[model samples]
Target: MASPAGTTARHGDICVGLMSGTSADAIDAAVVGITGAGATARLELLGFGTMPLPPEVRRELFLVFDQAERAVERLCSLNVVLGELFADAARTACRQAGVPLAQVFVIGSHGQTVWHQPERDSTVPISTPSTLQIGEPAVIAERTGVPVMANFRAADIAAGGQGAPLVPYFDWVTLRHPERSRAVQNIGGIANVTYLPAGGDIEDVRAFDTGPGNALIDGVVTLLTGGTATFDADGRLAAQGSIDEGLLARLLADPYLNRPPPKTTGRERYGLPLCRRLLEETGLPEGALADPAAPFSLRQRALDLVATVTAFTARSIAEVYRRWLPPIDEVIVSGGGSRNPALLSMLRAALDPVPVVTLEAYGIDSKAKEAMAFALPAHDGLLGLPTNVPGTTGARRQVILGTLTPPTGIVPRSQGKEGQV
Candidate 1:
C-alpha cells in the first residue's frame, strides 16, 4: 500500500506498539499505520496479538513489584526477559500481518512499569513521579532489528508532567465524534478516563485516573482463592457476592477518589497490601463473610472487592465529569475491565442516565486501545511534534514525548512540511 499524502512516512512507516499494563497479566502488541495529522490522523490497525506471561514469571513479578525488599539483581534480570518477550511478541505480530521485520519503521514499547511514584522529589529519593518500566529498548532493537521507542514516560515527567493517561491524545484523535460529547474510560490495573466534549477544542479535553480497576479486585481474588484465580473472571465471582455497603463506603472515602484531573495513580497505591488492609479494616471474616459461604466462597470475597473497587472507579469518573466536564453525552469503555460483565453492569447502573458504550463500538478494539495510543505518541515523536497535552499532563509546555532508538545502520528521517517524512 502506498503511504497517504501529508502523512509522515519514509518508504511508508509500519510501527509496532507494545504495552503491558498495570495488571501484569499479558503484553499486547499491535501493528499500526500512522497517517494524517492531529484530529485528522488515521491509525489503521493492521494486526494485533497478545503474549501471556508465564505463571511463575507473573508470580515473581507480583512479589518483586508488591513487596519492599525486592532484590536488584532479580529486577535487572526480569528486564531482559521482558524485553525478549516483547520482541518475540512484535515478531509474532509482524508474521501474522505478513510484514517483514526490516520493513517496520519503529516500535513503541510501553515497558512494564515495576513502580511509579509521581510525588517523588529531590529530598525524597523515591517518591511519586519516580517511575521505572522494564524491557530494554536496546534489546528489543537488537533482537527485532527495528528502531524502538521505549521509556516514553520519563520525558513527560522531565517536562513536569504526570506521565500518565497519555492515551487521551489518542482517544481524542480516534474517538471524538463531532456531534457527541464522548468519554473514553480504560479499565486496566487502574481505571482512567479521557473526556472529549462535543465540539470542544483540544484545550478543553480532560483526562485523569479514576481510581482502582481490575487491580484491587484481582488482588482480592488471588488472596481469597489462594492463587487459584488471577482475577474475578467474567465478573462471575462478583455476581454472586453482595456489596458490603459499609466497606464500599470506606473504600470510596480515599482521597484519590476525590482528586481533580491532571492526576494519575498505579498499583503502588492500590495493590494487594491495600486490598488486605481494606478487608482487615472492615473486620470481614477470613472465611466467607456472607451467610452462603459455599457459592460465594472465594467468589463472594472477590465479588465484594470488585463491587467496592468497581464502584469507586465508576463514581470517581462521574465525579471528574461532574466537577470538570460539561454535560457529557456518552461514556465509552475499553481495556480488560470492559470484558467483565459484572463490573460493566455495576458501571452501567452507577452511570445511569448517561449511556455507556465500548470503544469497540467506535471501531477500536478495547484490548488494543492502549497499544495504539503509544503508537500515536511514537509517531508524534518521530515527526518531532509535541505529543503530550499540556492541560492534561501538566507539562510546562508542549513537547515531543520519546527518545528514538534507531536500528543499526539506519538514519532517523526528518518530517517534512505537512508532516510527511
Candidate 2:
C-alpha cells in the first residue's frame, strides 16, 4: 500500500531481500524495514544471514554456466533447486532477526545469474542485450507465501540498457552525502562503482563494472589448491607473493577494461577458462592447471600468478576512477573484496589522496550491503516506482525492475502450514 504523495510516511513495512551474487557462494538474506519514498526512504536493517550453497549444488550450477549452451537441462532443473535454497535462506534470516515470516509482505530477490550478455557479440546471438536470473519467483512465493519480485536486470535491458550496476540507485539513496561527492564501490565477484555527485540528484549518478574482483583471484586460487581451498583466506596467499608489474601491465591492456561505462561482465569473461588461458600465456608449466589442478605448495610460479591476478583486480579498479567518475571526496568499499587486505592495500595505493573507507563506518555490514540494496528497492517497487538507474545501465528510459509472484490465501508456511504459497 502506497502513501499519499508529499505526506511523509513512517513505521515501515517488513520485507526480505535475497541476493545470490555471481560467486554463487551463498544466498544472503536481509530482513529490512523500509519507510518513506524516493530519496526520503529510510532503510532499517533488522537482521542479516547467509547460507552456503551445498557443495553438490554449487558444482551443478557451475556445470550450468561453465558449458551452459550444452547444459540446458541442468540449467532448467537448477532454477527450481536454487529457488528452494533462497526460501530457506530467507527463513533463516528472519529467524535470526526475530521477525515473523508471515509479517514479511515482500521478498526482493536478485536470483543467481546463469548467464548475462550485456551486448550481442560473435558468441552471443541475441538481437539485443540480454540477461537471465534463475531462482523462480513463483517457487519462492509458493514456498514462503509472500509476494516476490525477481529478475531485476531484464527490464533495463529491454529498454536498450546494459542491465548492470542497478545498485547505484540504492547507493544514491542510502550513501549519498549532502555536500561531499561519493564513490560507493562494491567488490563482489566482479568490481563495480557508483559515483554520486555532491548534493547530487538521481540523474547525476554514474556507474559500471571495474573488471574482475574476486572472480579471477578466486578462480585461480581454487585451481591452485585443487578445490581444497575456495579462496585466498584473508589474502594470505597474495601476501606471500610479489606483484609482477610486467604481467599486470599486459592484463591491464584487456579491451574489456578499456571499454567505456554502461558495461557489465560475469563468469562468461573471467571464469575458469580465462584463468587457464592466463596460465598458458604466462608459461607456468603446461599441465599445472589440468583437471584436479596442482595444490598450492607456494611454488614460485603459483605465487606469482596469485600475486599478479590480485594486483590486476586492484589496479583495474583504480584505473576506472582515473578514467571516469566526478570529483570524488570519499570512497566507501563493500562486498567480499573489502575483506582482502592485499586488495585494499593496492586500492589505497592506486587512489592515493582520496580516502577509501569501509561500509561498516557508515553503519552497514559490508557483506550484506548488496542484499540491503535489493531490500530497499523491493519495498519501493511495490509502491509503483522505477528502481533501475538509466545512466548506469544505459536504459533509454526507466522501468519497473522486477516480476512478482503473489502470495495467496493458503496458510502461511511459517505457521506450520503443509501447503505451498
Per-model TM-score, in order, reads 0.90, 0.91
What lDDT score is found at residue 32 in candidate 1? Answer: 87
Residues 1-421 of candidate 1 have per-residue lDDT tens digits of: 2224533353246778999998898999998886665676788888899999888778778878866365577788889999899999999998998777756767899989998877766786555666789988888888998878888888788889888768888888887877999878898989888888887777877888888888888877676665667787788777777777777777677888667768889898889889788667655543333334456354455456656766666666666667766777899999898999988888888778999998888888888889888877877677667777877878777777777777675545533434422
Residue 223 shift from truth in candidate 1, angstroms? 0.9
Candidate 2 per-residue C-alpha lDDT over 55-142 given as tens digits, one digit per residue, 9 for 90 to 100 = 9999998888788565888888899999999999998898889776667858999999988988887764545578888998888888
Candidate 1 overall lDDT versus native: 0.78
Instruction: Please report the candidate that would top TM-score against the real structure.
Output: 2
Q: After superposition, how far is residue 322 of candidate 1 from its true place, in Å?
A: 2.4
Q: Which candidate gets the maximum lDDT versus the true structure?
A: 2
lDDT of 2 at 399: 84
* Native-to-model Cα distance after best TM-score fit, residue 5 in candidate 2, in Å: 24
